[model samples]
Target: MLMSATSFLASQIRSTIAATVHSTNTLVTSLKSSLGYLGKDSSTSEPENQSALSSVPLRHEQYPSLQPWKGLDRRLKNYGYTMPVSSNYIAPRYPIVLCHGLFGFDKMGPDAIPHLQIHYWKGIHQALNKLGAKVIVARVPRTGSIIERAEDLHKILSTTMEGSPVNFVAHSMGGLDCRYLISHIHNKNYEVLSLTTLSTPHRGSPMMDWFRDNFGVGLLLQSEEDAMRKLGEAAKLSKEAVQEASDALHSYLQNVAGRVMSSGYRAAPNPSPISPLLNKLIPYLDTPAYANLTTTYCKEVFNPNTPDDPRVSYYSYGASVPQIPLWAPLGFPWEVIKAKEGENDGLVSLQSARWGEYVETVEADHWDLNNRWRLKIGYDQKPFDAIDMYMNVATRLYNNGF
Candidate 1:
């Protein structure tokens, strides 16, 4: 059931989708596979046939590094991005890499973007370019566990930057993926000069559980573990592959990224079965193994409340957003979140987002952290002017040079 098992045949995607998704989810929504930006294609045929994607390739570079990959050069322009003119004064030699988060892609879904009037990476990339630092966009795998993604990041770094990334600006769970790479994956050979994350789920997001409660449609929207977990589970087909990838992800993140990441977004990973495919895909959902896995990566063990970033440092802009509590009567065990109230974002809580040492904050929502929105996080008034905040953060990074 590996994507590489067969050539790029149209039916191949359909068959893989059928196996990957159950009858229920397929009926409700499509499964996540080697999918591409929808609507952009504007094709009469099903996406499987029309899509030229074999999983969004992961390779990115921002600084006009010498000998950049041809593929990278094309994608940089394809994204309609270019070297942004710096503003103010921040002399940092290292450029920036803009990482995409869940639902961050230009073509995530029909309803997710376009109308929102706010795109994080594009907005920020342009902002920082004007702020002075050269910006690069990291087109990472939208689907795959942190380990898999970290490995993808490794590939991108190796090929594009020639082994070391000058800096990174990630968002959402993308932060977690990067964390796993730096803290756990241990890619010491590569040099990561700095990192800045926006609205990332440093902890897990309770939304994961919310998605499980609403599994019928959640899977199609976004996997709780995001793309990495789904891809990791799928990749679990081979343990050696899993270990190798996980090791690489951990090495790059823990070793390389940890040293260079000056700032980042933080959020918690709250477990849930939002997507039926992911829920079913979890080999150990609601079981001891599930708890063990989560616990292993929870605040206590893997990405705990530590001073990991005292040297490189980290800052956050998140607080808990209330969700109606669920009181599962007697059947559920202690492991069930059971509708606990705590610091959170619109989905992930603040306590969950807590990682590294203290930095600073504003009356911002998880999304509001970026200063680009020009408003605030609320249904009534859109958060920070997206353009303003984007420029602020980028300029700040370029100036701070952390």
Candidate 2:
């Protein structure tokens, strides 16, 4: 009986080992086939034709074990998936005009490193153009009064597109500039078909006030008040840093300002004059103009003056990324903005971003809305292409015959 039991145990052990070996072999084969398939896929097609995040999904085809089982695929069909690349399929009736906001630029840095020649709109311009959209990147003043910047934009559009009507996709303060241009500068020579603003502070930002308080009134002045302004003027500012956070110190200072401003408004019912220091500091900051963006100012001053143009169609896209450590590049200011204004896209709040036909709020920070350029600048979050957003917008405009 003992001998028979030992033989039975040995047989069971052999069967178990055989099953394990078979399973291991199957997995190894699946992995090898998946890797081989991916290698072939890469060499077979040009990089541009493929989605940036396609490799993971493409590899799954070779491995049945790795893929979702039967019914799960149907449920997840629409979730977190990218639209297939439609080459040259997104042409709009009018040219697509891209307007950059305050401290924004068309292109910056040396041409030597091709990636460093990053546009404020990032990869969207090139991608749109490839898709047969006539994309024009407007180079406006980095920091100036709305009127000044609008006039500059007027000059740019007038000179470049020869006064033809174009679809205006403005970001941040650029939306304010377009509105000003439409309200005040519309004529036979200047016409806009559509105005789409992403993360614009239609209702002014308290950050402007924060700047005045922290750096004193001199911060707002057009002339150099402190090292910050001087640095802004002299430095060839990083396009990402300019549109997003300035630096670690500035971000920390902004948090302090946000807290102070929130407390001040809570303590006082009436809006008081900005500190006497601001009065002493030169008005170079366009204090009144910047203030016009504030909720109070917009409701009182700006909205009253700049009504929507009936001819130009209006749309706005808002963004709200998860706070802080979600994207370290956006820094501490996002926390402050989130604290003061519910949800924010690092800079512009969702409420403040609302203007014209409220399109949709996306899950992206101000910078995340565009290509962070992971391969190039090392500041990227993959699978969230700003180009895709722009393409979708352009496609919609085309479908709408705009």
Candidate 3:
């Protein structure tokens, strides 16, 4: 009876081993399929194409206004990106200068900290260099007016490129800077062959107008005074009573604003609590950068004064996502832009992004254009690859003989 029990146990062990082997094989096969490795036709084993085929159709059905990828090149239809860069791609004749937009930087953080060093252009510069294109990533003040940033960019290019003609591929506010440079800052030291702008606010953004109207201290105070006046009229209160109420509201708002500023100061790297006088003065600081982005300013002031240069070829591309995700950092801003300007890529509207020789709009957001948002933990599978789009930009420049 003991011998019989031992044989049964050995048989059960063999069966368990076989089951484990089968499950392991099945899991490997599933992974291969998901990665586009086990396609029926092996020749067209592009993972992006597979992903696009699955996701684009569903998205188009849900959002009819979203540009359909039906007739576009199979590779670009879904994600607005090209195939991986290969040896056959031609490099542009002139060196490509990449300009960053508002709050942009060349690099940030220390390299010693893992995943801390952030690049504004990300892997785009290296990819362009790998394709035999000389690339320069231009850095300027994060929040300076167009002219101020343009002057800085001019100085940097004049020193670095040293008279070499370049193609300006500016993104967002960077486009405005390049346009200002091309029109105003004509240093005979360097020549600009072409200016390609991606999602630039050439006309201006309604979102900026919204921010000014809703959040500006002057506007907020005016709105509150109007409300107080209406309350006095309805309640049959005396004019003095209304005035007193308005003054109290103003004082309360000032105290609240002071506390908010103090908290922000304390959160800074080296905290020195700002005095009440400085807190009051902060709102009146002359920050032209934010003011310059307003629709009224861009339409009435900047665009009228800064005309496009005839000597340089100008091309602009707009970006749009069907809808902002719930977790997107730009969700509220996207809604604001969408309500006023229809479809937008969070910050700049498609209507505003248009300028000299408008190119086709692509499927991306403002941050996606720079590959910044894609670095987040759960964003690895995003279809739009900024590297591929920039590669296509270089190819287009080469084809145009720039």
Candidate 4:
């Protein structure tokens, strides 16, 4: 997402502290608020909000754009999008923040946290930039949860893009993290323009039951930790409202059915001899929300959202790798998609991938979602034109104001 200068600075200071020093940065000023007490807490403090990923300032060359959008959507008025003709549109390519998924490796030398895959984000970022967006791959000690990640983003906004309007387009769980930041942690003020999720197991993927119980789970991934965090949050509540929420969520998933570990989805190889005992645990857990996030799943996206982001719209995208053999990579095992229908770039179901406020589909796997080695090797795998997906989103976000 796009953010102003002031928002970026406040967030940076917080991230440098939270990640580098292992501290937290919750108290920060909104772009419009005075930063008079930079490091000081208000004496008669009111309820504080969690900060989000720090927004960063961009060099003029970074955005390389015309003036920022001067729109009058009333919502944009406060966020500093300014009011001007559509022709004065600013290319939103200023600074987009890209966050890695759970257990994503972060490199040392502080070399901007190296992305594990060589092709990771290289294609994605290049395409976004060609369409006028600057990509910022962010690293933290851990996102732990979308809410926490969102808070970090909030902090980034404060420290980095202090004066600018920011937009966020997150992948999978990252989208969930954005929602947590905007809905629960936010102080009911700031506007996030738009948010989109990619293959986010919003209702919770059956995969989690496998990852933690079968494979393993770690706080190394903020979103992974969030499963526990939300469980914790869910546990603390006894409100009738909360019960209704869970019930609604439950009812929703039961309807949009898909393959679980059952239906022989985990066949042939069964489990690898190397980790056969561990693999055995997978087929046990029932998939609760495989197809639940579909429009038919629930009446609406499950959110504690206030006003439901009149300005910020929601979208989702997923890959569909159906015929996954009995073996695959670490992130996605072949058992999950083997014998399924359609091709899911590699990990997400194409139908699931289409969950955008507006959806776009490309011929790519989960890896295709990112830049790849370019050799394009894989059966049933399609080489995605990252540039296409990038431009598709860029033109929409910039022109549509999300």
Encode model 1's per-residue lDDT on 167-236: one tens digit a residue. Answer: 6666666666566555444435656755666656565555554433343212211122232343344243
Q: For residues 50-123, what per-residue lDDT tens digits would candidate 4 score against the true structure?
A: 22112223332333343343122323422222233222223563456665554442233444654433433554
Q: Which candidate should be chosen as best, given TM-score against the real structure? A: 3
- The deviation in Å at residue 352 for candidate 4 is 4.5
Regions of candidate 3 where Cα sits further than 4 Å from its true position: 1-84, 111-115, 217-286, 374-382
How would you encode candidate 2's per-residue C-alpha lDDT over 1-402 as one tens digit per residue? 999999999999999999999999677545544555335444444353333334433433444455554235322222322333344346788898898877788888898897556567665676677777788889876766565678788888887878677999988888988887776553437568999998888887666545444543312221211223333332244455433323432343333232122232322222226566655554444442454344544454455556777888999999886554634655566776777787887778898899888889888777666554432143433234566678789988888778
- Please give the ranking of all candidate structures by TM-score, highest first, separated by commas: 3, 2, 4, 1
| Clash totals for all candidate models | 75, 7, 0, 73
Ranking by lDDT: 3, 2, 1, 4
Question: How does each model score on lDDT?
Answer: 0.46, 0.64, 0.71, 0.45
What local lDDT score does residue 346 receive in model 2, on the 0 to 100 scale? Answer: 71
Expressed as tens digits, the lDDT of each residue in 1-402 for candidate 3 is 999999999999999999999999677556556645567754554565556545532333344333354335333523333333544456899999999998998988897893677788877777788888999999998977675688789989888888699999999999999987886554349889999999999888877766555444211223323333443342345656545644653454344342121132112222114565654554675244665577765675566656677789999999988787546677778898899888899999999999999878998889888866443343333467677688789989999998
lDDT of 1 at 92: 49
- How much is 323 displaced in model 1, in angstroms? 10
Candidate 1 ranges with C-alpha deviation above 4 Å:
1-91, 106-120, 163-165, 187-189, 212-297, 304-312, 319-339, 363-379, 398-401
